[model samples]
Target: MRKIEFVSCHRLPERSFFFRGKQFPFCARCTGIYVGYAIFIPALWFIKIDIYWALLAILPTTIDGLTQAYFNRESNNFLRFTTGILAGYGLAGLSDFIAYWIVHFFKYLFVN
Candidate 1:
């Protein structure tokens, strides 16, 4: 089954944090991003953010990934995942912040 194959591919060492766990390769932050998005997007449906500002917050991680990909240096998976998680959280926080600002701005413009 596809699930079995996926699990087998990410088998970690016995000492690893995710040793024998279902979610391997992805650390706490990465897991947080995936789980957070599931929760946050619905929240954003009732609230919205400036898309550009959110993108700006996510830019650093994008740059890091692109640079790492294009360069010839061999980096380990851990560093890659760390950067990814940081970027994901940064984007999430930025989205939330922008959404909050937009809501406040609308409240001020309409109510005041």
Candidate 2:
């Protein structure tokens, strides 16, 4: 952004966009990731999508990243953001899965 004071702003200027001559706080991918996680943190409580589904959600992000890294393919911000969102969902779901299993394991061990 114009402010250039924030850490993320400085770190990801190329990845960010300039609308109305104002730079975004983070790159498209980062924005999507943050937004997705923000959405997931709260909504995750209500939704019970399985870990396999979560892996499916994360697939796109991994593919995109791998292709870009190895093939040197160019990409747009919107796509980056989209992949980030998918990754974010996976990240949240995986975290929930781990936490859920851990709690259950302790409960089962201690209770029995």
Candidate 3:
């Protein structure tokens, strides 16, 4: 019975929210990205704001992964996952204000 349940659940669709165990809307990196964004965005908004610094911090992950990917040396899951998380967090922090502005702009442009 347990084996049947595990097999059935494992074969379920990724987008479906009907599985067991940990529940995340997206995968691991996505979860990290969203959570990181929520924590860092507000802190950066109220504290010291430096987009350049954030970019600098995130550049290593970007360049390393991209170059490796381009060269077809992308067998390192750990490296890719780490880089993706860092880049996602950095983008979220740097773009929070821009995201808000865009949403507000769209709201006014589309509504009425």
Candidate 4:
């Protein structure tokens, strides 16, 4: 539980999902994000997505979270989960992009 909490706030019981009356370790949105990562990480090797498009994919989550945090707007679990998936995919793509460039940079610097 501590390790899970290290990665997620796990705050706000209402935002979490429960099974058999046991709460999930992470919130619904976080669960979706992790699920997205699981879906996309393996695909990164075959799918070459541009960082710009990946960043664009993250916009919906950013907007939704900001709106809810600042304006006190209510958000449903479905919306949160969907947006989290998008954000997670985008984040994975961004990480891939950065790692690719860094590796190339080092190869260029050392191999050339």
Q: Which structure among the candidates has the greatest lDDT? A: 4
In model 2, the runs with Cα more than 4 Å from the true position are 1-10, 19-22
Q: Model 4 scores what on Cα lDDT? A: 0.87
Q: Which model scores highest in TM-score?
A: 4
The per-model lDDT (C-alpha) reads 0.56, 0.82, 0.57, 0.87
TM-score of 3: 0.48
| Alpha-carbon lDDT of model 1 | 0.56
Ranking by lDDT: 4, 2, 3, 1
State TM-scores per candidate.
0.46, 0.81, 0.48, 0.92
Clashing pairs in 2: none
Clashing residue pairs found in predicted model 4: none
> Candidate 3, which segments miss by more than 4 Å at Cα?
1-28, 96-112
Between candidates 1 and 2, the lDDT winner: 2
Off by over 4 Å in 4: 1-3
lDDT string, candidate 1, 24-75, tens digits: 5544335444554665566666766465655664665576557756985544
Please give the TM-score that candidate 2 achieves against the real structure: 0.81
Q: What does candidate 3's lDDT look like per residue over 38-84, in tens digits?
A: 66767775765357866765786667647765986543434544655
